[model samples]
Target: MNFTVLVPARLASTRLPNKPLADIAGLPMIVRVAQRAAQSAASAVVVAADHADIVAACAAHGVRAVLTRGDHATGSDRLAEACALLGLDGADTVVNVQGDEPLIEPALIDACAALLQARGDCVMSTAAHAIDHPRELDNPNVVKVVLDAAGRALYFSRAPIPWWRDGRIASTAAALPSPAPLRHIGLYGYRAGFLRRFPALEAAPLERIESLEQLRVLWHGERIAVHVAAHAPGPGVDTPEDLERVRAIFAAV
Candidate 1:
């Protein structure tokens, strides 16, 4: 049941510059994310930051953080360095909570960790929810995941997976599949050992093509347990509009 939440933060963002340090209400976005993660069942919550300013911001907000190499290609790579820095045991559970997700539900974080703990056969765990909107099936921005009977992800893609054969006609295209296709959630949980080994795994062709990192795990013949959540998660900060929306939500709270 013991798990650590690692929030990977970096100051360099093309959409919103210095995104991690961006102000949300009175606190930095990274600080807000760490605070939310702290509400989970994690034994500890730490921010793995690429910039000194990000680390300083977390410290100012009383959130533990570690300085990671700024050159890391992905958040997983940054978290791998963080795992070493924290000296996490191989068997320990580490949930990767994105620093931009200040509105992430703590229960979702706990569920991802608990699922990873329960599925010893799987090296990682993530979440998904039934896609209620028909438009989302065609929206590449909303990643989709097809799962096996046991709830292990068979694949993750931007394309409409488990494509409805009978619904191929334009008139029926808007109809959802028999069992709704799941919308992949970004939340993830990893075993410390697999996380450490993650950086060394060769980037999969599917990963590069879809621009999805989780594909590398599947390409390497690793299992990722999928927890189907009842409701969709809150919006994450990505663009200026997303930031403003999140700010409005926080202001209301």
Candidate 2:
């Protein structure tokens, strides 16, 4: 579908420094991520890094890599800069694959892209699924998204959305029907032109309060088409314990 996958890798992770280069099975996590994205049958796969070491590592594994400004506020900004550096065409679609998600399902990547292509009016698209656990609903780290019947996001929040007026899950469960409180997947797919235009959107109060960059788009009144993935999203590496868990998962796989 004339698309590319951009894997943004920052070397100095506050939680896990040099995380992109961290080993998974036999390859760096970022390399494995790029390979998985490549499985989407994307026209090209590129690793956008801020450090020379990351670039070298990507090259070592024969993955296309490019250097970008390290000061980007978020990976989306870094991806935009990478798109500019690589001279990516504005008409093409670029998938923002998280570098830490080495086990990301390729079908999810394809699904996100398919939504963007099938519904061209939305400049950006993402995936979501029902939050299976009540504990996850309260965890601020787990972003939540609510979508309209047309599959367009209504809001993204760190707070428990569709808040229970009764103040507890025990009561809330009885009030509502089955299936609810969609969890936002960190993955994104964007038009190359939209990626270039994204950085200009000013931060809104809602985004600042929640610390989610995606909210800026919603606050600005832009529609984000949502795709409901068939499978649960892959794990994201954030802490040392997460790395150990991921290592064990990979070992088992």
Candidate 3:
């Protein structure tokens, strides 16, 4: 049950500059994320930051952080360095929590880690919830994941999957599938060993086209267990509007 939670944060964000340092109820956004993660069952929660300012912010808030190279191409790359820096063993479990999700559910974090530990056959685990709205299914921003009978991810894409063949018309399908398609949450759990080696895996064509990193794992014949959460997680911060929404929520609390 012992796992580490790694929050990958970068200050250079295109949508919200210095996003990790953005204030939410007087606390830095990354600090809030780390605090929420601390409520999880993880043995430790640390922020893997690209900038010293982010590290200092975390430290100021009594949160642990590791300074990583600023040039990492992806969050996973930053996490890989964090794993090495922390000296996590190959068998250890690590949950990757995004810095922008200030209201992320700690129980969801715990569930993802526990699932990874239980599914020895899988190298990683992630959470997803059924899509209730047709517009969400069509929205490219909402990534969808299809699962096998054993709850292993079959595929993840921006395009609506389990596409309703019978409802297709004019190249615009707006029908909700019978069983409900899943919207993939960005939370992830990993075996520290697999996580360390992930950055070296060959990029899959679908990954590049879909702009999803998890496809590379499938392309390399690695399995990812999917946890079907009861409900969708809280909104994550991605833009000024998202930040404001999260700030309002925190302020009310």
Candidate 4:
């Protein structure tokens, strides 16, 4: 079970500039993310940074960091460069952990990696949790995934999926049927070989419509194993308010 956790960190965030350097507790966000990833079953944890400052910040915490091209179209692209820089083999597994997820559970990381190993037919793997709240079912921000009988993702969308025929949406309320929806988590696990080729795959229309990079994999007729996590993942920092919330949570600890 040899695997590496690569945290792709970029300095320029439209919502929160220098987001990777944002402080969570006493450490930078990327440093905190690396620390959490290190706790997982991964053999190594590295921060794939797009800027020198991000690399320096990780170094300050004694974490391994690699500087990647600033113009990478996506985090996956940055990860491919980091893998090549590290000289990883094609069979090696790599987990793409976002730098903003300071509260990410180490178990979830291990689960995704393990799932990819178990599902030889799939090139990638990810995690999801059952959506308990009715509001989340309709919330476009919460990505939903429908899984096949084999636990492979059938489709991923911002819209409520597996739409209940019996249920109806009203002005004040919406009726959701039995069997709660699954909320797709952002974590991903990729084989080093497929990761390198991922960037070259043409962007699918569904991917652009849903703004989900994973959709491209499906559109290209690639299978993605989806593991239903035993527990829900912790919140990730995305905006100023999200940062403050994470800070408060860390301060309490």
Candidate 4 deviates by what RMSD? 1.3
Where is model 3 poorest over a 10-residue stretch in terms of lDDT?
A: 168-177
Off by over 4 Å in 2: 170-177
Off by over 4 Å in 3: 169-175
- Compare candidates 3 and 4 on lDDT and give the better one: 3
- Candidate 1, lDDT over the whole model: 0.93
State the lDDT of candidate 4 residue by residue for 111-209, as single tens digits: 999999998999999999998777888889999999999999999999888786776532245545667789999999999999988898999999998
**Each prediction's TM-score against the native?**
0.97, 0.94, 0.97, 0.97
lDDT (0 to 1) per candidate: 0.93, 0.86, 0.93, 0.91
Give, for candidate 4, the lowest lDDT window spanning 10 residues. Answer: 168-177
- Which candidate do you rate higher for lDDT, 2 or 4? 4
Summarize candidate 2's per-residue lDDT along 125-212 as a digit string, tens digits: 9999887777778778788888888899999998788776655654235433246688899889898888898898888898888888
Q: What's every prediction's RMSD, in angstroms? A: 1.4, 2.0, 1.7, 1.3
TM-score of 3: 0.97
